[model samples]
Target: MSKIQFKAMVVTEINDKQFSREIVSRDVSTLPVGDILINVKYSSLNYKDALSSSGNKGVTKKYPHTPGIDAAGIVVESKNENFYPGDEVLVTGYDLGMNTSGGYGQYIQVPAAWVVKLPCNLSLKETMIYGTAGFTAALSIYKLIKGGVKPADGNILVTGATGGVGSVAVGLLHKLGYAVIAATGKPDAKEKLLKIGAKDIVLRNELDDKSGRMLLKENYAGVIDTVGGNILATAIKSTKYGGIVTCCGNVASPELLTSVYPFILRGITLYGIDSVMCPMDLRIKIWSLLANEWKLHDLEQNVEEVSLEGLNTKINLILQGKLMGRTIVNLDL
Candidate 1:
């Protein structure tokens, strides 16, 4: 085999308070030894990547680290019995993008335990388009279905609907024959949200107040929430009896200040979703669903592709909350 040096987006902390990311050269041999090696074709940007790249010790403690949480590519090498060279594979949300080298690079060497055989229904580009954000959205919808939520039960609310997780959730839910009410902070995205299948659109500020009492109007049968803090509490209070609420992000705040009345009186179910450490069995099942019945045809409609050199612009855009849908990073650039 020939030796190769590739470029990767690396984040390093120059001081305890300052951190920055830049595309830098890395040797293939420098990657952490693993059972499988992937020539990463594509990756997706996520809020967590922003956190890790900006020196959030909670997501990453080391410097000079790549921060992509989603990768989809073909296997170049493998030592494990389950995978082989030339097999198309994808790896997301293990330790691949945290402290270990991740998909922001041209390659990633990861344990075979982290690889998921790519489903034939989607291409590598399609997989990263869904990425961690879409996976989390699917998981939330899956949980809602298991909780017996149905299209006719009532309107389903999706908060942060212009974001990756929220946008995908809205698309998936709308495709499943449910009435989706999308809430967004961006006034410009209303037509985009409606075009993706949302039945209604509302400004996020409509739900801004977290001071409402234990229960509200019993409006929605379920809610897919990506913004936490006050918005989460507001969603909880407003859900109908027997409603299910799935929450997965803390872009707002992690705190939950609310009464137990929604759970105790209305029999509401609040599920905490964690995509990073989800069990392998469940992960496999969800991926299978994404490939088959639960597949959203409009998935490609929500993606915006960019080159590695264009990443910093996107990072700032996402932080400013000006970007919508998913931002797919093309590493070949």
Candidate 2:
């Protein structure tokens, strides 16, 4: 067969004043050097993808680049004998959608080290449905559980509960039989959070409007925090004795300002969750759990499928905190 070309979303810098993204056609030869080439079926829209699309230099250092942190599909070409054509796989993080052109295309040439064989119980669409965001949530909950969190250990708190990470955390925590307290700035999301398994809804203002008294009344057993900042600090201070808090994002701000009172007095454990460079062994374990034990009750309820062309609007929606649940980008469509 002759060379097959595919469409990709490419970002271009327009002078110093503007940047633009457009669909461009290119052959597989244009991809960055790698051992495996994939025929992408699905990719998901993440906050980082939105940042890269809108010219966030920290997430994406270059223009004329494709941005997608998570992708699932079938192997079309492989130099490594470990993988052959037609084998299913998925790739997330580890410089993907960063300096490297990522899965916002019909094809992706990626380092074999960054790829994972799709678990047998999950399909291409189902894998992307969990995506990087869901994986991070799973990792967070895993750490909390490993640190001794349990269903009867009071209620678990999920901050930014309407976003992808928090939404998955709430669902998973609830599935594990924990009372979940969801926190969100949008009051309109209360009903949505409840449907997703939050037993209680705490307004953002109610949590962040504290007096910074070094510590507060013991409130939660554990917390899944995506919007780091005061919310994280507040949650830490309010956690019960021996409680764990897993923080994974800086959507609000990166700076963490809190005293050692919670740690010293309550023996609280603060865990930092990173999905990008997670160890392969742990990543496999988490993926297994996501596919089996920790599976959500309504995995498809919060999903909103969008085409590649629809990304421009959804990107803005995610950045504005107007979107809830997961937004899976249907690259094949």
Candidate 3:
């Protein structure tokens, strides 16, 4: 194929404290060894990708790298027997966009183990709309349900409710018939949150409890906490006895400051969600559910579609916590 040339968003470190991004030409031959090579059609922005793009050495060890954790496309070539050219597939997490050349490019070469065949009834674009954010939300909900949370139990709380994972979690919980309470710092987004199925809106400040009381009056049956730090600690204390709380992202802060009362006294279950290393069997199962019964009909409602050239703005917005819902990238543009 003469080493197909394509466009990609490249991040290069200008100095120890300065980084730059631009769309540049790249060749397929530059891709690392993998079992499959994908002609990437779509990708989505994420907080981790932003960190990597901005030269967060913790998320990415090197610069002059591509940062896209989520991708969907058709297979162009394969060394693995399970995948064939022309097959539609997607890849998320597993070192992609981190240290690996990711889907911000028009192509990606990933291990066979990291690839998932596109589920029926979902298009490549639609899959990117969900992406890793939706997958994390699904994993949180799945763990909650498996921990014995039910729709009839009580109201469920989704923190950071305007962000990608939080928004998707609210929709999925509402679709499953749970009363969802969305918490956000942006009061202007109340109507948008409600449109996505949040039954009520709570200010993010309300959840940032500073009262040293080890326990608060239990309120929620379960919680999908996307923001860690004091918000997560408050959610743990405020959850009803025996309730389940799933912790995913740390946009608020990674340091969780609280006591063990919520776990010991209230018998609450706290599940830490790790979408990056989720097992393949469970990953496929969750993707199937998302494509079928759990799929959100309005998945594209609040989503913004952008091109590789447009991702720079969205990345800055996400890093500043100014972006809402999802932003999917169309490589063809």
* lDDT for each candidate structure: 0.90, 0.90, 0.95
Per-residue lDDT tens digits of candidate 3, residues 1-333?
Answer: 337999999999999999999999999998888889999999999999899999999999988998899999999999999999999999998999999999899999989999999999999999999999999999999999999999999999999999999999999999999999999999999999999999999999999999899999889999999999999999999999999999999999999988888888989999999999999999999999999999999989989999999999999999999999999999999
Better of 2 and 3 by lDDT: 3
Stretches > 4 Å off in candidate 3 = none
**lDDT digits (tens) for residues 1-333 of candidate 1:** 226698899998899899888889988898998988899999999998878878899999788798898998878877899998888888889887899899999999998888999986988988899999999999999999999999999999999999999999998998899999999988889999999989999898887775567788888999999999888899999999999999999988899888989999999999999999888899989988888898988777778899888989888888888879999999886
Model with the higher TM-score, candidate 1 or 3: 3
Which of the numbered candidates is closest to the native, going by highest TM-score?
3
- Candidates ranked by lDDT, best first? 3, 1, 2
| C-alpha RMSD of candidate 3 | 0.7
Model 1 CA RMSD to the hidden true structure, in angstroms: 1.2
Error of 2 at 325 (Å): 0.8
Model 3, position 24, has a per-residue lDDT of 98
Among all windows of ten consecutive residues in candidate 3, which has the lowest summed lDDT?
1-10
User: TM-score, each model?
Assistant: 0.97, 0.98, 0.99
Best by lDDT: 3
Model 2, 98-204: lDDT tens digits are 88888888888888888999886787898898999999999999999999999988999999999999999999888889999999999999899999899999999
Clashing pairs in 1: none
lDDT of 2 at 153: 86
